[model samples]
Target chain A: SAVISQKPSRDICQRGTSLTIQCQVDSQVTMMFWYRQQPGQSLTLIATANQGSEATYESGFVIDKFPISRPNLTFSTLTVSNMSPEDSSIYLCSVGRDFTEAFFGQGTRLTVV
Target chain B: QQQVKQSPQSLIVQKGGISIINCAYENTAFDYFPWYQQFPGKGPALLIAIRPDVSEKKEGRFTISFNKSAKQFSLHIMDSQPGDSATYFCAATMGDAGNMLTFGGGTRLMVKP
Candidate 1:
């Protein structure tokens, strides 16, 4: 199992500010993903961070809002740009090697005020 | 479009009893099904998983029952304890999809002592 470490476990940001959450994995992985969990809601996929390539955003999500960066197999970052009250949610990073269970980071709880 | 659907938004189970959560998916392309457990202020952890070819998979007190024909799966927790109280989510993914997962609306389980 891979061990993932996410920074900024919790944060409070102004409505117009942007925050970048980092994720570091103890081991190399083939795929990395980012998800959002709103209060009392299910986890939603934000994007697939491909190393050396642009992230693939899911429907209803775009790069302008959630920019993701995967510099290597062991690290990735997600930036919530132009935040708003609706942007408050828990951001999570996940890493996987193959067709197996993926490991998740502790998650970053962002509260936009 | 919500590809995955879950039932029983919340449930309460007595200690030593059984806790069950159900999920269904519309996409047959999903070949991997996994359940996750999450406590407040933390990331979700993979609990148990099963493939489409398997009818059931059990690990200790956790079990996953999969019905490929019905496109449904369920998680069962035996000998439930107070510590078992947490939010559970069911997710599905396709191997070729770069491990992108589709998650169901999580179920909050509260095991009373």
Candidate 2:
């Protein structure tokens, strides 16, 4: 089992601001992913954070909007570049270890006002 | 098009009853199927999973039935309790290329006592 942690459980941010969420894993992991969950909806994959390489983003999501960085195997960061009411949602970071199961962080809840 | 599809946007079950959530996938390339459970304001946690080679897997009170031929799978929570109320997501992944996951729409289940 892998234990994951996310910083700033929640925050109320104003529009046009940016919020950077951090993901930390207890053990070294190969893959880390960022996800966004809109209100009353399922999770949407934002990007795959690969250590020492550019994050692989999903369609409709761009690096300029949600930049992700994974400098090491145990840590990653996701930045919501510009905040908006529509961007108010829960951001989650997940880790896949040995291709067994995904372990997720507690999530950072951002409420863009 | 959505790669994974889940049914019963919401469900209500009585205590000691059965809670069932179903999912289907359109991608034949996906080799791993997993179910995740999320409480309000919390990130999703892996609940159970199955591979294409397995038809059924049971862990405690939760069972995953996989139908590889139909590209369908379902989660069954036996002896449902109020503590089981939460949002459930069924996801599939290629288990390669960093093991990125494609999530289904999700199901909200409420087990009443």
Candidate 3:
């Protein structure tokens, strides 16, 4: 199991602004993922962040909207760009070690007003 | 299309009773199945997992039953307790896919005392 720490547990952002969430892992990992969980809904994978490479994004999400930075094996960041009401959701960071199971951070709750 | 389907968007179980949640996947390439538990204001945590080679995996009070031919799996919680009340999600990922998980619609379980 990995210990993940995410910042800004809850925040209120104005529309058209951007919020960047950070994820730090206690142990080095090869794969870090960003996810969005809408209220009362399932989680949707936003992108896969690998150290020293461009993040691979899923359909319906793009780098322009959710720019990701994985500077090293233990740290990553996800920025919600040009926020809107629909962008309000809980953003999660997860790390996969050995492809067996993934460990998750506490999550960041963003409310775009 | 939703790659994974889950039943019973919400569930209510009496304390000490059994709680069951079912999930089915359409992608045959998915070889890993994991169950996640999330509480309010927290990210989803991996509860239990199973592989295609295994029929069942049990950890403490939680068990995962896998039917490879049916492309289905289920999670069973025995002796439900109020502390177990939370949102549960079923997810699948293909081996070597960087562990990018495709998640099912979540089930909110409430265990009453």
Strongest candidate by lDDT: 3
Off-target runs (Cα >4 Å) in candidate 3 are none
Give the per-residue lDDT of model 3 (tens digit) for B35-96.
Answer: 99999988899899999999999999999999999999999999999999999999999777
**Candidate 2 lDDT tens digits, B7-113:** 99999999999999999999898888889999997889889889999999999999999998998999999999899999999998886644578899999999999
Candidate 1: stretches off by over 4 Å: none
Stretches off by above 4 angstroms in model 2 are none
TM-score of each candidate structure, all chains considered together = 0.97, 0.96, 0.97
The 10-residue segment with the lowest total lDDT in model 2 chain A:
A96-105
Model 2 CAPRI quality: medium
Best by DockQ: 3
lDDT of 1: 0.91
lDDT of model 2 at position A95: 92
How accurate locally is residue B2 in candidate 2, as Cα lDDT from 0 to 100? 49
Stronger candidate by DockQ (2 vs 3): 3
* TM-score of structure candidate 3: 0.97
**Candidate 3, A100: how far from true, in Å?**
2.0
